[model samples]
Target: MIRETYVLVERELKKWVGRRGTFFISLITPIAWLALFGKSLNFVNMFSSAGLQGANPVIVKQYVDQTLLRLFGTTNYFAYLATGMFVVFAFFQSVFGGVNIVFEKRLGSMNRLRMTPAPRSSIFLAKMAATLVRTFFYETILLVIAVALGFSVDWNAINFIEAGAAIALLAAGFISIFEAIGFAVDNQEIMFSIVNLINLPLMFASPALFPLQQMPWWLRDIARFNPLTYAVDIVRYNLLGVHSFNILEDWAILIAITAVFVTAGLLASLRVLENY
Candidate 1:
């Protein structure tokens, strides 16, 4: 199984590396998003909307500063927003990760593989592993762009390693879930539609773009069960020293969710073999 997995991983990596244009485009996208949405969005009004009309500037400044510290662990909104983009990108990776399977099935590669002795799980695992590598690379490039854009991502080596691990877990878990959906569904259009439908809601409803406290009661309640919320919290705590939940509990929840999805995805992948 290890050898088979390695072979598939290598093949997938080569395929990915061959797409230089796609790699470059992916690297550019998050930076563009940070520039357009992260830097441009105005959150000042939300802070001042507490009917503090006659409040002194000094009081406002202090209150805002304290609020920022309490919520995001920094007064820099750009940094907070930039770090959250990692979570957004993670979802993007997961959403598209399984499309390759559909393509493989269309190309007859999946059919050929299913006839071989290679474990079906290894094939999907190889794809996930390849995507994990891509996710790490994406994070590294995003961090560089973020720093260039004045996003404070000051973290020690230990925290940086932890962040990377958290991202790996996030990508694996999410990719697996999507692969499960991909395996079950034959129509690529439906998968594409599902991705489009979930992306915006998941991204906005989570703490990735905005603090949970700032959201309405209903949205906050919804975000409480969002895996992206825990993933974002883990990344924020490690990368930006910002945390909204207990680190241990966040990791625990993320891992638990990942385990469930992984199990489901494996079963789905094995079930897909019968179709071929």
Candidate 2:
């Protein structure tokens, strides 16, 4: 399984690398999101302009930092927002990761692969593995952009590892389901429609773009079941020293949910393949 998966994975990577225009173009969205969204909501400026001008300069500075720290867990809002963006970007990327499978199937590449003696599981695992590689690649770039734009982090190797693990776990869970959808569907339009349907609801309902505390009670309840919520919380805990949920509980819940998703997606994909 490992060897077969490797060969198939190599094919995916080669295709990815060969499409230099696509690879570079794909990066533009995340970069623009990180740049504009990260900088536009300048909370400090908002508060600073709210009438602290006559106060002692040092006192005003301290008050502003303290208020921001109380609300955002950091003196900088960008740091808090950026940490969440890490998870959000990965979430969106993984949601579309399986689109390649739909395309390959449309182009007849999937049919050709099915004719080979390769294990069916290898086809599934190879697509998932390649998606993971792309996810991590984009994540690293997002982190660099976040830091360059005033997103402060722990800067510890352990924090990076923890954040990465959370991202991987989250991506794997999402990729699994979408990959199954890709394999089962005959039309790319259906796969894309499903992606669009779930993408924003999942993102908005979670604490990916805002603090959980700030959400409405019903929304927060919904976010409780969102893997992105746990992912964002875990990433925030590791990177920014602030988080909405307990780390241990977050990990446990995330692991359980991912296990369910992965198991179900695998069974579904294999069952569909059996019809071929």
Candidate 3:
């Protein structure tokens, strides 16, 4: 199983690398957000008004300074945005990977693969492994750029392990949701529209840009129900050492979401196969 999965994963990875345009398009939004939005927004300045509006000027200055200090740590704005960018990349990659299977169906590749003697589970797992591997490469390239621009990372083994686990779980959950969507939808154009329409809203609705405590009441409630919020929180906690919730609870929620999505995706794939 492991060897078969790896072989499929390697093939998909090569395909992804060959599609340079797809990779660049996938990366452009995240890069723009980090380089342009992060610099323009200047989160510190945006929050300054709140502190200044308070009773004491001295207290406001102290509060603003402390908040900025905590938010940025020793790194600059790019590093702060990198956490959000990583989540965005993972979400996009996994969701888009689902549509590839549908495309393969149209191209007759999926039918050919289905005729092979391998277990259906192996086929599903291989696709997922491919998606996860590609997402990791996307993130690694982004991180390399970030580090070149002076993002600081703690090089401890625990941080590396935790980061890898978080990325894997996030990719798995997102890919599962997308795979289910792929099976349910027949029109590729509609699928693309639905995915794009739903993507940015999820980012904005989550605590990706600001802390949940700072969000408006309605958005806060929405974020509470968003699975992406837990993924973002977990990634932020591991990569940036920032915490917006109980660590254990957040990890459990992420894992649970991954499991549910995986089961749903597998069932959907099975049904699609049986129908085909």
Candidate 4:
């Protein structure tokens, strides 16, 4: 199984490399977020002001010490925003990859592949792997830039490993959900439209730019229920060693969501292929 998976992954990687334009375009979103959005996210103090004012001075000091200042290992607000931007980029890549799948289906590539002797699971796994690799590539480039810009992180082996695993899991879950949508949709344009429509809202609804505790009560509740929130939280924890909840609980929720979404994607893709 491992060998077969590698073979399929290699094939997908070749295709990805061959499409230079597509690959460059994929980097644009992450670059824009890192360069543009990262600058605009300097309102962290404003966002946290209300919560800070309402809390006891000592408690506020502790919160700032534990979360914003100490947890991130830096007092720079941009570094904190960079962590959230990385998560957003990962989720966006996965969701956008689903549109590519829909395009491939419309182009009849999916049907041609289906008629081949290759295992169906191999194809699904290959797509997921591609999404993961692409996301990692884009995010790593952004991180390098962030580091160059003076964003300091704990350069430990454990943090690096955890960050990679967290990103992979988050990408897998997001791709799974979007792949299900691709299976259900018949048109590439419609799929693209739907994905873009949800993109901004998902970012805004999550704790991407600021902590959930800083949000209004209604928004905070909504963000708490968002899977992207968990991904952002875990990434922040891994990158900065600061967490909003128990580390074990965050990992469990992320793993569970990945499983559910992967299962749903497989069922949906299989049903659609079978009918085709």
- Model 4 per-residue lDDT tens digits across residues 1-276: 566667878877888888889877877876776678776654345546766556566665555556656434546667778888888888888886688788888898888878877777777777888778878887888889888766788888888788778778888987987877887798978987898798888898987777777778999888877778888777888887666877788889889988988898888877776776
The top-ranked prediction according to lDDT is 2
Across 1-276, the per-residue lDDT of candidate 2 in tens digits comes to 899999998988898888888766767776776688768876555666787656776777788789887777878777777788788888877866678888988899888999989998988888889888988887887788777887766679998898999999998989999988888888888988998899889988887677878888999899897889999999999988888778999999999989998888888888887785
Best by TM-score: 2
Write model 3 residue lDDT over 1-276, tens digit each, in one string: 677667777777788789889878888877777767766754445565655454465666566667765654423556666776788778888888778877877788877877877676677777888888778887888888777656677777787677678778978977877877776677788788879887889888887776777688998999988877887777777878886889789889888888988898888877776677
TM-score of each: 0.89, 0.94, 0.85, 0.85
How much is 47 displaced in model 3, in angstroms? 9.8
Clashing residue pairs found in predicted model 4 = none
lDDT of each: 0.82, 0.84, 0.76, 0.78
Q: Report the lDDT of model 3 for residue 112.
A: 86
TM-score, candidate number 3: 0.85
lDDT by residue (66-176, candidate 1, tens digit) is 887777678888888887898788778777678877777778887787787888878888888888888878877788888888887565899888877777777888899
CA lDDT, candidate 4, residue 133: 86
Estimate candidate 3's alpha-carbon lDDT, on a 0 to 1 scale: 0.76
Model 1 CA RMSD to the hidden true structure, in angstroms: 3.0
Task: Give the candidate order by descending TM-score.
Answer: 2, 1, 3, 4
C-alpha-based local distance difference test score of model 1: 0.82
